[model samples]
Target: MSAPGAGPALVLASSSPRRRELLARIDVAPARVASPDIDETPLPGELPRDYALRLAEQKARAIVRGEGELVLAGDTCVAPGRRILQQASDADMNRRFLELLSGRRHRVYSAVSLIDADGVQRSKCSENIVKFKPLHADEIAAYVASGEGLGKAGGYAIQGRAEALILWMSGSHSAIMGLPLYETRLLLKQAGYPIG
Candidate 1:
């Protein structure tokens, strides 16, 4: 295993453009990107926080790698109460998600996992609370038609048109967007990546 701060090579095990953009914010680019194919279905009775962590770690583990490569992966889950919401795959699902968020507060759990060159792994989770405005039927319908909610956890993209409907949010915006910058940087730094 590379010693702490030994600057091992880095690989990203995710296909998320948002994560790419966020990594650039810290001026650390991965040497390569790998798309790990894995089933993301929530386990029966699995809580959102645990699911997020498991997915992140599994993605990192799923990546095929060479020696001296550190693989990074992340997952984000939206949970209201104990119910974990699925990505809105259709307009109907989007509408239903919006209805669930209307005048309500929910938690977003974002987890980042890193598998170091020596196969040692570490992970961290960012938890945030997001509140939405009481959405009316017309706006919900219009937003659902916009299609921004599709494939997004909680059926809304805060960086897109959904911003207008947010009442308040307390958490890492990067995490909500898909990856947590603060935690990601910390993990990388400890794993020996110079975030210059």
Candidate 2:
């Protein structure tokens, strides 16, 4: 799918600027960014890791792959036990998410899927543990009012002010932010997408 040392053109199956920014940090750029439309509703009793992987693969497959083009997709979610915390759709839901996450450890699962030019799909998932400091009612209220939590998984953005609330974290910060760079780089390199 490539001539000499060159790699196949990459099609990022996501519109997330964050993901694109993360890729830029590694000096990898997608030839195109495709927005994938998929129903993100989790199936009943589906585990968090499985749910994330499924969404990533589904998103990659949803995009039409051109000749010699590779499609990459990602999914990230916060899971408290078996529950998947979705992006909060409203202010109240955001507040509730913060309340539930307060003073506790939760799992952030980031999954990535890459489809090579040969149509082989490779995927990986990263699980990170994060603990937030005990949040006061006023704190939650202030955060909710700031409106940064809305539309973010677990009702918070790790790269934003929410990082201040985190007391500790384990695993990849990039994973919590939405893409696992280490795992992603390995997949891309394995699929012959040139990277150092």
Using TM-score, give the best candidate's number: 2
Query: Stretches of candidate 2 above 4 Å error?
Result: 1-5
What candidate 1 gets wrong by more than 4 Å, as runs, is 1-6
Output the worst ten-in-a-row residue range by lDDT, candidate 2. 1-10
Q: For candidate 2, lDDT tens digit of each residue in 1-22?
A: 2233377899999988889989
TM-score to true structure, per model: 0.94, 0.96
Question: Could you tell me which residue pairs clash in candidate 1?
Answer: 7-192
Error of 2 at 7 (Å): 2.1
TM-score of 1: 0.94
Q: Could you give me the TM-score of model 2 versus the true structure?
A: 0.96
